[model samples]
Target: MTVKDIATLLDAKIICCEDSLGRELHAACGADMMSDVLAFVKDQSVLLTGLCNPQVIRTAEMMDMVCIVFVRGKLPDENMIELAIERNIPLLSTKHRMFTACGLLYSNGLHGGATN
Candidate 1:
């Protein structure tokens, strides 16, 4: 699905890079730990995370993630937002908790691409 589809599915607010809403993503990873994300992320995927910090943006950029969804109604600070915008990554925020948000996207066909 596209980033816009994920935004609609999670009832998330598009925080930046609205133009990237059309980008297609085949998978998702939900994590609060950047280390796990770095170890498991797949190609052009979405990251559903609860950690609201600049490191999250940096990790997503390094992983080449399609976008980031901040769960549990958490929003990043201005610095993180600026970093995301500079990286040309779309950021979304949702009121759903991490598990629920990840489940919603998974149920809609976005799978976790990491393999054991």
Candidate 2:
């Protein structure tokens, strides 16, 4: 599915980089810890997290992720949004918790790719 489809599936609000909504994403992973994200995530284009910080954007950028979804209604500050915008990573916020959000995307055909 595409970033736009993930946003719709999670009923998320696009916080930045709306133009990237059309970007296609094959996999997703939800995590609050950046360490786990760095260590275990692989080939994932979308990240769903409850952590609202600039590091989220940085991690997404480093991982070459196409989109980041803030779950549990958590919203990023302007600084984080700016970082995501600079990196051209679409940022979205949704009311669903991390698990629920992940489930929604998975149920809609977005899977978590192989990870070590």
Candidate 3:
């Protein structure tokens, strides 16, 4: 589904990339550990995390992620948002818990980036 659709469904705030709201998101990655995100995520444009840090943005940039969703109402600080803006990654925040958030997206057609 599209970024806008997902944002609407999750009741997330789109902190950036209004233009990219139409971008199609094929998959999602959920992790709070930045290192694990770096190690595991691939070709996954959407990241579901509770960590609100600059390193999160950096990891997304390195992984070519298009958007980041802060789960459980976590919020990114200005520096993290700046990094995301610089990297052109849209940032989103949702009130849903991590597991429920991921599950909602998965049930709605989003898949894990893992290959069979």
Clashes of each: 0, 0, 0
TM-score of each candidate structure, all chains considered together = 0.95, 0.98, 0.94
lDDT of each: 0.90, 0.91, 0.87
Candidate numbers sorted by lDDT from highest down = 2, 1, 3
Among residues 3 or more apart in sequence or in different chains, the pairs in candidate 1 whose N, CA or C atoms overlap within 3 Å are none
Per-candidate alpha-carbon RMSD to the true structure: 1.2, 0.6, 1.4
* Candidate 1: segments with Cα more than 4 A from true spot: none
Segments in model 3 whose C-alpha atoms lie over 4 Å from true places: none
lDDT of 2 at 108: 83
Clashing pairs in 3: none
The top-ranked prediction according to TM-score is 2
How do the residues 3-111 of candidate 1 rate in per-residue lDDT, one tens digit apiece? 9999999999999999899999998888899998887665748888899989999999998888999999999899998999899999999999988898888898888
Clashes of 1: 0
**Which prediction has more favorable lDDT, 1 or 2?**
2
Estimate, for each residue in 1-116, the C-alpha lDDT of model 2 and write its tens digit.
Answer: 88899888999998888889999999999999999999999989999999988888999999999999999999999999888888899999999999899988988888889986
lDDT of 1: 0.90
